[model samples]
Every structure is written in structure tokens, then in C-alpha cells.
Target chain A: MGASSPDLIVHVDTFARVNMVYEVLSVISVIMLLAASLAVLITYNWRVCVLSLAVQYLAAFWLINLDYPLAMAAVKLVVGWMVCAMLGATPVDLKQPDEQLPGRLFRLLASAMVWILVFSIAPSVLQWVPTGMVILWGGLALIGMGLLQIGMTTFAPRIVVGLLTILSGFEILYSVLESSVLVVGLLAIVNLGMALAGSYLMTVSGGLEV
Target chain B: MNAPLIWIVFPVIVSVILFFLSARRYLVVGLATGSNLFFVLLGLLLPIDRLIKLGPWAFEVSSTLMVFGRKFVITDSDAHLVVFLYFFAAFWFFGAGVVRAHRLFIPIGQCMVAIAVAAISVEPFLYAGLLIEVAVLLSVPMLVPPGRRVGQGVLRYLIFQTLALPFVLYAGWVSAGVEANPANQRLLQQGVVLLGLGFAFWLAVFPFHSWVPILVGEAQPYVSGFLLSLLQTVVLLLMLGFLDSFAWLRDFSVLSQVLQLVGTIMVASAGIMAAFQRDVARLFGQAVILESGFALLALSVPGYQGAEVFAGFFAGRLLALALWALALSNLAADGISFGFDHLKGLLHRLPLTSIAVVLSVFSIAGLPLLASFPVRLMLFDRLIPEAVNAVIWVMIGCLGMLMGGIRTMMVVAHSQEGWRFEERLPPAILMAIGLLGLVIIGIFPRWIMPYLIQLLDPFQSLGVLMILPLI
Candidate 1:
């Protein structure tokens, strides 16, 4: 083969480097998403649960950025963090130190099945939703785990976190489909409303002012 | 002048102001009632997109308002719906104090109404899911205000409603794609199925309906009645909006058959279940389900026949449900048991309220002279040829509801003690007015129903699908 020109060499090198950056980021996002959601499901510590939620949103931000600019995708990150902060600060004793060791192990085992189900269904979901592989995996994973979380708990704080996680998952999937500014704004409003509603339930059930 | 600005945005602004003024309960009630009344009048009197001159002052109310690249359109055809909504809202607000509803009732109520209107009027229509979700969230505070533990009913409501959001938005997206390529049979099926599931959750169809009685039982009857009434009505109307707008979906005859099947299940289940209910609060929930059943049945009818009955259902439902809820609220205020067994001899203590309760239930059951009877009869007449089995089950459902009503009346009227008139003035008057309204509607439906039937005019293509029940 003939020697490549200097300009062509630079162009080829830049293309490979860009692909490398994407591959690295994708792996990181996948890792963060999986670790965060599993932690949320298994942890009873409120601080750990809240931190995992924030980190899950970070994974969400990365997935969303695949479709939108960093500035636009930041809406999901900011709103998700705000929700985490709000629910985390509630006066109610959300720190449920009550579940036995078996319960945590059971949740972990159940979540394993959920992950299996997500992988099994992601191919089918892709056929209909028309999103990227990373998104399909991350979005479906979050949704499946989030639903598992909601199903496992009756406490307001956990339910709200689960709802936000599911919403963020949906946002990731939907961001790739439609780019309407208003839809993004409305979805953000929904996240905040869910958090506010959770806080209200917590404060009231914890006790007084009606 | 803009139609959306007047009907949609104005209520939101009012709600915000009312939220701050809520501590002044009387002022909030007055403002909510006045604002709703104003909306009713404006909807009835003004013609959208038409200029008129009065003493050299002229203005035209435009139909569409664009914001953030999306359109909110409220046209002349939609005026009747706006009128119906606010008119019913005013009725509820006017009775707020008598029911001793929370001070937040009016403000949060107006917010619910505004969000509901937005759900109806939002363009591209897909955005309706988010708006509806907002409306659902707003209901939380009302259902579980400060000082009360969040009931399982509220939690379930939140989860079920949240779950519906994804299905609806996803279905809308799917349908949009299918519309671009109509030959995609698999995608079409998926879209239809998703939309059907979304409606099932939103409207609380049979299997998903556990939350209905639970919610009505746990929360105050007035609040539950208002929320369920608005939620169901809007969702039904939104379903109609979908039918009117989407050709591929509506064109499928399977849609009608499915709706009929679903409607029959809801009615039969609600009615049969209502018969066994001991608590009046739960009975109210069943009553709501029964009405929803009838509305669905109306849509399942061959054509415009279903639509008229459907529209008429909306008109009759508000009066019957309002009266039923109002009567129930009045009884609740006296600290009486909602359980029929424990409520023996309540008629002697609160005769007007007891009568109101029985009459409202009787009306919902489609008794001969109730507001819903004419519509129910019309629906039966249409369903007879199409699905005799449905008619049989529906009648059974109707009879079941009527049986529940009779049981309530029996409990209310009989007592070991002597009969006494212990009802106070304000509630007695309110109950009496509702009773009269139901009677008038039952006797002369045409007078009022014509107005509500026009609610379907906004859904031009669904013109053949007039109201079995408007919200």
C-alpha cells in the first residue's frame, strides 16, 4: 500500500481516538448504571440509597447526552439530583433499619432475575422503540430494577425513588425519539412533582397540619 | 382575546393566587366558585375566532395559542366542554364549606381543573400524558393532606397512574410511526394494545379498579368524588379525542368490540360488587365504575347513537354523582357511620340527606325517573341488537346498583326510635337542590342534554361518537 499523506494520517488517528473515547464513556456509563440501581435495590442505608440514585442519574445524563447536547441533557441530571435532595431531606424516619439480612439477599436475588429479564427483552424493545443499544440496555435495566424497587417497598421514600428512576429510564429512551423542548420541560416537571408528592406524604404520615 | 388564555391559563393563574389565599377559606371558595362561573359564562356566551363590536369596543377570541413550539387549541366547538367542566366545578365549590372540605380544596381543585383542561387541549396530543400525570400528582395533596398518613389507596393510585404515563406516551409514539407506514401490522397491533392498556389504567377498568373503592373509602367522599369524576370523564373524553384524531386505530372494528367487552365487564363488576358493599363510600366508587361502564357501552354502540347516550351520561353523571357525594358528605359531617349496618335509623336523624343519598344512587342505577334513565334506555336500545348478552349483564348491573340503593334506603328509613327531622338548613337546601336537579334531568333530559351532547362537537371525526358521558 502507498504511504498515506500527513493529513490523512491525522484524520484516521482522530477518528480512532473519537471512537475510543465513546467506547470508554459507554463502558463507564454502563458500569455506573448497573452498580447504582443494584445498590438502590439492596441498600437500607438512606445515604447510600440517595447517593446511588444520584449516580444513576449520572449514568442517565450520559445516555441522554448521546442524543442531546450536554446542556440539554443536564436537565435530567439537575432535576434528578433535586429530587434526590428533596426526598433525602424529609423529616420522616426513612431510615428503615428494620429489614433482616434475608430481605436484602432476597432483593439481590430478585434483582438478578430482573437483569436477566431486561437483557432478554431489550432486543424486542429495540425493535419497537428504535433507540441505541446502550440506551436500550441502560433504559430497560433502570426501568426493570426501578419497578422491582417499587414493587418491593410501600414506604413513600423508596416508592418515590423508584418512580424517579423509572422516569429517568423513560427519559433516556424518549430523548432519542423526540427532541421537543416542551416535552423535556414537562418531563422535568413530572420528576419534581413526584418528589414533592413523596415529601408531602412522608411529612404528613410522619405527623401534623391538616 | 385567546380561547386558551381564557379557559386554560386563566384557571392556572387563579389557582396560584387561591393557593396563597387558601388560609382565608371563605375568600378562596368565593374566588373559585366565581372563577368557575365566569368560565362557564364565557364558554357559553363568547364565540371563538369571531370579532364583535360593543359600543366601539371590539375583540376576537382566537382559538390557538402557541408556546414553546407546541400549540394549545380551544376552539368554538370545545366551548360546550369548557362550560360543562366549570359549571360542574362551580356546583362542587359552592358546596365546599357545607361539606367542611379542607381549605386547600378549592385551590388544589382549580389546579386539577386547569391541568385537566391542558390535557384536553394540548396539541400533538401525545403531550396529554404528561399533563394528565400532573393532574394525578395534584390529587395527592388533596387525598392525603397534612397530618394524615398516606393511604394505600393513594399510593396505588400514584403507581397505577405513573405506570399509565409510559404506555400512553409510548403508544402515541408508536401510533405516530404506524401512521407514517400503515402497512406495519405488528406495530399497529402493538400501538392499539398499548393504547387500550393505557386507557384501562387511566379509566380504572375492571382489573385495575381496586384503587377506586379503596380511594373513595379512605378519602373524604367529596374529594374522592370530585377527583374520580374529573379523572374518569377527562380520560374518556381524551379517549374520544384519540379516536377522532387517529384513523388507523379508530378504523379498526376490533376497537369497538374491545370497548364493548371492557364496558360490559366494568358495569357488571361494579354493579354486582356495589350490591355487596356495606360502606356507602365504597358504593360511591362502584357507582363511578358503573357510570364509566355505561359511557363505554355508549361508545361501543354502532355510531352516533352511542355518542348521544355517552354525552348524556356526562350530564347525568355530574348531577347524580354530585348529589350522591354531597349527600354522603352531609352524612359524614354528622359523624355517622358510612357502613349501612351501623347507619340504621339515620333517616330519622338526617331525612333530607338520607333521601338525597338514596335518590342519587337510584339515579345512577337508571331507575325510571332518574337523570341517567333516558340515556341508559337509549344505550340499552342500541346494545340490544348488537350484544344481547351485554344488555342482560348490564341490566343485572343496573339492578345490582339499584339493589344497593334499596338496601341503603331501607337502612336509612327504618329505626327502633321515632322519626325526627334533625337536618340543619344549609345542607338540607343543598341536598334538596341536587334532588330537584336529578328529578328534572330524569324527567326532561332533552332540556339539558342537548347542551352537553354538543361537547362532542370538538372531536369532529368522532362526531358520530357523541357523549355517553362527558366529564
Candidate 2:
């Protein structure tokens, strides 16, 4: 499930050009990943959260494709989107009151700090992880932001999205080392199951409040 | 039939059937109990890898079943464990009926047991982490029943249990590297730390144990008891299996000392907390924490004697917990709040149940002539000379629990002025039988020691440790 040397060797110059394009795409995807994470953290609307989650999955696919084959990367992308759809279908009425400018500013500052932390540590982590620097930093950033989202909210949909983000980051890093189909399938099940549990809890919590 | 088919697949099938028939509460309970008993008998009587004639038909069971390039093996040596797990399932299912718990308890509880068995039996044991996660996921519905608000305890329990997965998987990955480069101390240390963190989360060790009381406080007493007993037993067995599988891990010199330290903290803190708890349900949680502490101490004891101590302690605690949970469930059914304020002078209205509840606490606290006493004595006798401080802390924990029991007895037995001594037929009989079983086991623990020791046979690497007489 990888590119053969003969295919690369036959058109070395062309392969190099394609690799440069892939590198640019990977960088762009990482930016989108962070943007989606920020959207989920800053917004209280479920629709906005769902849309950002979809963007996160799309960006994760491109980031994962930097190391993993397109097919393997698609497995993660599909599972992420399925989880997003499941969560979106649930009726989560986030009753969070209006946040003042100071609250928004504080959240933004916290997220920036997380980004700095990830960027600082990714260089050292890249030595051990079996992936390119771009993929590693992107995965680490997603994980850090996901953790922030989870820690900041008790609302079920946001927490579920946060969980998905964390899992996506792990999958990106794990794919670089192990490419077992069984592991991928099991992880997919975990993602879907987690989404279902989140949806159930959301409804139950809502019902109890009513 | 292969062992996996018999032990794993069959039980899973039964669970699915029970789930569909959940509306028929009695039938579901009866079927679950009957199936568990059948498996226990099968484990005891069937000879794997050897033909046995039964009424003109000859058959032999295979020990291994391969699925998707992975092997699930259950050998002759695992017979005792298989029997014990199934017997526990039967005991739990039977009590579920007596307590009239949620109808889904038997079905989901059956599945949880099967997955736990599979977790222990799975090859390349790291997969057990994922299996355990699945079991934890299955428990959510049971923990927070339908139409109920999800409590912080349930959420925290899920989060903590899920958090163990990555640690375990990473440990498995690193351990493979250690196997390749045995001299690499860095890899060894990393694997040990990761594995330790994973087990600590799984077992709910100190600082991670806040969920225990919260969970028991919110969930039904019977469900919480069943979940705690089942998960703790499996996780402890998995920890033992980890040690047995890796010689480096087992031979780590400081391992026993570390275990003793953790065990001491759990015992002391839980005991002190139990004494202060005003909520009856939370007291049950404290007892569970104390039970985990004792289990750790049992593991800390050197040689196969540790294994014997663990099995005996586990057996006694299981009985004690079942009785305690049953009594609590009956009280809850009577519309009584578990808080101290509501429990005053209730012994007159519920004489047998009150006795069972107090007796169960005393049993767990290691009072004389109760189930846990003999094992507690064995553990203390073994540890006193080697770790005197540990002995002192354990005694202090036991004393705290005894004090709590005395206070509870005094409160319940105050006897309201106009209260009548009322008792129902079924619960009275059940509580009496449970209390009687505790006493008999305390007096004749030897009846179960042979079976308990047999559970140690699967870890062939521990053969050197097994040279010591278990009793």
C-alpha cells in the first residue's frame, strides 16, 4: 500500500514536482485544521460546530495523505464525517449565555498558547514519529486544540466534537507507524460508538433539564 | 468446538438473546443464570484435547480458535478461571433477580463478562485494552439507565476508562521494541511506566478513585456492585497476566514494594473516608476501594502465595459485596433514601435486611466469623514480619471500617416508638442464605482454596514461585 521505487525512479523529476505540490497542500490543510478547531471552540451553535467538524475531517484527510495512502486516509476521513453527521443529527440546545468580548479574547489567547506549545514540541517529537514535520505538527496541534475544547465545555456536542478531533490526531500519527486494517476498523467502530453515546447523553441531559 | 466458541462466542450469543427478551424480566434472569451455570459445569467437566465418551458419543474440545490472523486460546490450565468467572456471573445474575434491578442488567452484564473473558484470553494481550474499552462502553447504558440524567460519576468513569486505552496500546508498542533490544533500559522504563498508568486507571488507584464513590452514589446499588466486582476482577487478572507474560516486569525488584505502598494508601484513605461517609450508598463505594487495596496487598506478597491470597480475598469480597448490594437494593425499593437522615430507626421495619447490611459491612471489615476474616488474617500474618508499617496501616483501615459498622448498627437499631417488625418472605430468605454463606466460608475457607490455587496454574512462568505451599 505504498509507492514503488520503480514508479518514482522512472520519473524522478516529475515525482519531485508532485512532492512539492503535496507539501504545499499539506501546509494549507494544517491551517484549515486549526481554523476548524478554533471555530468549534469559539461557537455555541450546533450547525457551526458540525460544519467545522466536517472541515476538520477534510483537512485531516489531506494531512494523513502526506504519509498514508489515499485509501487508508479515506478510512479515517469517512469515520470522522460519520461521527460528525451523527452528532449533528442530535438536538443539542446549548443554553450557554452570551459571552462578553473579554471571554472571547481569553479563549483566543488560550488557543494561541496551545498552538505555540504544539509548534515548540513538534520539532523534538518529529525525530521519533515516523512522519513528516508538517503532518506531525498538524496532528499535535489538532490534539492540543481538541483537548482545550474538551476541557472548556460540558455541552455534549462540543465534547463529542472534541473527542473526534483528538481521535483524528491520534489516527494521523498512528497511521505513520502502523497500517493494519484491523486496527483502523476497530478505531472506526470506537469513533462511531462514541458519537452514538454522546448523542444519547445529549438527549438524556436535555430531557432531564426539561 | 473450540474453547473460544464455547466460552466467548456462546456467551455473547446468549447475551444478544437475552437483550431481545429483556421485557420478560424473569425469563431473562433465569436464562442468564442457567447459561452461566451451564458454562461453569462445562468448564469443570469437559476435558480439552482429550476425547470423552458421553452416552455413546465421543467428543473433544480444541483449545485455540484463530480469527483474522489472531489466536484466542483457552487451555486446560484456564479451566479454573473459566469456571470461576462463569460462577460469578451466575451469582450476579441470580442476585439481580432477587434485587429486581433494571431488566437490562442481566443481558448487558452477561456481555460484559464475555468480553472480559475474551480480554484475558486474547493473544498479543494488548488487544485486551481495546476489548476492555468496548466493555466499558457497553456499561454506560447500565450505569445511567434510560430516562435518567447522566451523572458526573458516569461521565468521569467513561472518560477515565477510555483514557487507559492509548496508554495500554502505546505500552504494547514499546514492549515489542523492548523485546527486540532487551538491554535497552529506556524502552523498558517507558513500557513499565505506560503499563503502570494503564493499570492504575483500570483499577481506579488513588487519586483516580474519586469516581468510585460518585458512581455508587448515583447508580443503583446492585448495578454498581456488579460492575465494580466484574471489572476489578478482570483487571486484576489482566495485571497478573501482564506480569506472567514479561519476565522483566515480574523480576523488577521494586515492584512488590511499590504495590505495597499503593495498597497501603488505598486501604488507609478508603477506611478513613468510609468512617466519615453519611451516605449509605457511598459507604458501599468505600468498601469497594478497601477491597481493591486488599487485592493489591495480596499481589504484593511474594511467590504463588500472593496468587492464593488474591483468589481468597476476591472470593470473600464477591460474596460480601453481593449481600451488601442486595440489602441496599431492597432498601432503595422501599423508597428509602440512602442518606443517614432517612435511615434512622429502620431496623424495626426491615429487620432481616438491616442485619444483612450490617453483617455485610462487618464481613468486609474482616470481623470474626465472616467471609473476609480468614483471608484478611492470612494477609496480615504474611505481611507483618516483612512490612510492619503496611500491617499497621491495614489494621487502622480495618478499625475505621469497624467503627463505621458500629455506628450504622447503632443508628438502624434505635427502633422507632411505633415501628413494627415487618419482614417479607423472599428477601428474608435470600438475606439469611447470603449471611449464612459468608459465615460458612469464613469457618471453612479451605473448601474453596484448592479451586482458588488451581487458578494459578496457567502462569507457568510463576512455577518457581508456586513451590511454596499456598495455605
Please provide, for model 1 over B224-314, each residue's C-alpha lDDT reduced to its tens digit, 9 standing for 90 to 100. Answer: 9999989898998998888888889878769888989999999999999989988899999999988988888888875566677777788
Chain A vs. native, model 2, TM-score: 0.90
- Best lDDT among the predictions, by candidate number: 1
State every prediction's TM-score relative to the real structure. 0.95, 0.93
* All candidates: DockQ: 0.54, 0.42
Badly placed stretches (over 4 Å) of model 2 are A1-24, A123-131, A207-210, B54-57, B464-470
Provide the RMSD of all predictions against the true structure, rounded to 1 decimal: 3.2, 2.9
Docking class of 2: acceptable
Model 1 interface DockQ: 0.54
Clashing pairs in 1: B307-B466, B309-B468, B310-B467, B310-B468, B310-B469, B311-B467, B311-B468, B314-B469, B314-B470
* lDDT of model 1, residue A126: 84
lDDT (10s digit) by residue, model 1, range A25-106: 7868977898899998888677788889999999999989888888889988999999889878876444545656888889
Q: How far out, in Å, is residue B166 in model 1?
A: 0.6
What lDDT is reached at residue B273 by model 1?
A: 93
